[model samples]
Target: MEPVSLIVLLAMGTLAGAINAAVGSGSLLTLPVLLALGIPPGVAVRTNTIGILFSTFGSVYGYRREIAEEKGNLGPLMAVTAVCATAGALLLLASPGAALDVIVPILIVFALVMVIFQKRITAAIRAGAERRAARRGGAGSPATDGTDPSAAVSPGDDLSSAASIASAPTPARSPYRSPALIGTMGAASIYGGYFTAAQGILYLGVLGTFTGRSMKAVNSVKNLMSLIVNLAAASVYLVAHFVLRVEIVWLATAAIAVGALVGGYFGAHLAKKMPEWLLRGIIVVVALFALVRQVL
Candidate 1:
């Protein structure tokens, strides 16, 4: 590679890594650059996966505090994601690409919509949970002055009711670890392994909706999960290069990896300071751009 081309690849990789660490779909930025530089599509994708492994490592290091807080919740899901991602990578290695072309755009659109309405959806979920708890409490309480138990509580007593709810015994298992969440995560991981564009956005939507984690915490988990998926896929590509004699552009991979490392560290720190609205807005705009680009 010429010095000028190498510099351009590194610059693109840095920006891609930062975007990925902060939100996701950094491949949207880097892959096009690689193609423009005359790298073959398959080689570019595989090389990019290798580069992302480094970027994600930096992101994980930057988000270590948040990761530590959520480690217990992340353990099982990580295993599921890794295993499913490997499967997806195998599929990618064996199959032709046309099948997913249509599906990808639709999924991206859905992910964008989920991000946009996340707050409202979460609020509705909380309201439903509260209503259920109120009904359960009402059933056991004795009526006084012929008043309905649910309606009998005064506004001032709401705090006490909430306190009682808080003091209720916690379940041994978190609802976040339910089969549905696991299945959804596995599916997303598979998609990530096969086609990575906006995979982080999909992860954010899933984690935000199901885990009810704060955006920062969810993004932290997103980085880890994405790392696992890319790592697994990259491993497959590495094996293919060795065993099947597939070509890999080592210079491009090195450039991206080095740049991504720097960008990931800074992006993680930046995300920590970003306001929720701004983070959400970035996710929406980037996802939409990715979606349109993919369709075109």
Candidate 2:
């Protein structure tokens, strides 16, 4: 990569990492930037996978407390996500170039829908959590989900408490029993395979359906779930592209990984400080812009 391209990639990666960490759609920025840089669509997508997977380590680690809590809850969810995501990744690898162009717009729309309902989704989760709390006499409530709605606990405390709950399970069953959960994972896998812009929204949305935790609590879950999803997809990309696109693949992967690390830190910080509304608003505007770009 030239110095200019490298610099641009770094800057984009940093912002994208932050966005992914904070909001979960940094690919909207990085992927487009890669395309603009004259990278082929397939190469760009593969490169982005590298960037996001590497970047996610930092973002997920930063929220390690939340991840730990969600890990226990993720047993079944991960199983579904892994299978679907792997299938999607393999499909993308096998698909012809013309197909991706047709698919990108649809993925963008799916992402847009996810972003639009982000707040409502989180709200529903909280409401569910509240109802669950009442049913359990406030005993088995998950303190955090994606963004905590409760006023009683600090975000930090809520995250820690939720982690505790996840680790203290009595049920031997997995959390992926819901039909809605399975369908959403399939949908999310498609979106991740086609384009990961706003995947966090899909993740958060599905998570909301299953649990009643704060958004922060859910976000923690989203990040970990995303990591698994992305990692599985990334592995497929590496295997598929290893022979034909070695140089570009390695370079793109390295750049994306580095960018993801920087972006992850900023995104996490923003997630904690920024209100859901602001993030939601940005998601809406960006989705619209992307939609228009696709349609026009």
Candidate 3:
């Protein structure tokens, strides 16, 4: 690639890292640049995975507080995600390249639909959680309300009344193992293997089951999860490149790592201040761009 092209790749990687940290679709930036620079599709996937690894690190560091609190549960989740991702990466290597052209577009389309339904899904989960909490109140647990049972109503009445009280918006909670987490990790591994843009959104949508955090908190976990999966994928890619000896296409992976580190930090910081809707809007726009680009 020309120096000019390399420069463009670096810029794109940096931006991708930042946006990825911010809203979860950094691949759209790097992949096009890779293809534009004349890298083969298979090689591009490997290098992009390498580059995002740094960004993942940066984002995780930036969100360390949130992660520290949730660290106890991360081991099992990361183990599952990493193993599944390794399998996905191996599958990518074994499959024929032309096969990806057919598969990738479908994955992109499915991800787009998933993005559209993200909110409704979250809302439904929140509602279901509220209902369960209400039922639990019948056991004489503290109602979400602060009032004491002895002060006013009977425990039975308080329990029933808890059902009538306005549902508190569920805060994003700490991470733990769950069926949702397992399924999401599996799905994300598949997505990571195929089309990786906005993979964070899909993971977060599922991780929502265990966490009731703000977007920033969720993003921290997202970065941590992405780091685990991308690193596992990168290991497979490294073996494919070295052991299988695919041609070296470009040298921007290290730079992507550096840029992503910086970008992820900022992305996490910005997510704290940015409204969820705006961040989400940015994500939808990027996802649409990725979908259109893949289709065209």
Model 2, residue 271: C-alpha shift (Å): 4.8
Worst 10 residues of 3 by lDDT: 166-175
**Model 2 per-residue lDDT tens digits across residues 1-296:** 67777776776677677777766877766676666666666667778877787667887888887667546556766787788888877777777777766676576666666676767666776577568657776454455344444655666676878768656868655444566666777778666755667787667766666654445566776787778878888887777666656324566566767877877865568655778677666556654664565455
Question: TM-score of every model?
Answer: 0.71, 0.72, 0.73
Give RMSD (Å) of candidate 1 vs. truth: 7.5
Model 1's TM-score against the true structure: 0.71
lDDT of 2 at 219: 74
* Backbone Cα, N, C clashes tallied per candidate: 0, 24, 6
Q: How far is candidate 2 from the true structure (C-alpha RMSD, Å)?
A: 10.9
* Clashing residue pairs found in predicted model 3: 55-260, 171-212, 172-212, 172-213, 173-211, 173-212
Candidate 3, residues 1-296, lDDT tens digits: the string is: 56776776676666667767765767766665665555556667778888877888887777788789878867777787888888888887876878866665566556656566767776777677668766878655566556675655555676666656535566553345665667667777766755566677777766665455555557777878888888888888877778889644547676666667776776555554667666556545654665566556
Q: Model 3: residues >4 Å from true position, as ranges? A: 112-175, 270-296
Which of candidates 1 and 3 is the stronger one according to lDDT?
1
lDDT string, candidate 1, 200-245, tens digits: 7678767766666665668888898989999999999899999998
Best by TM-score: 3
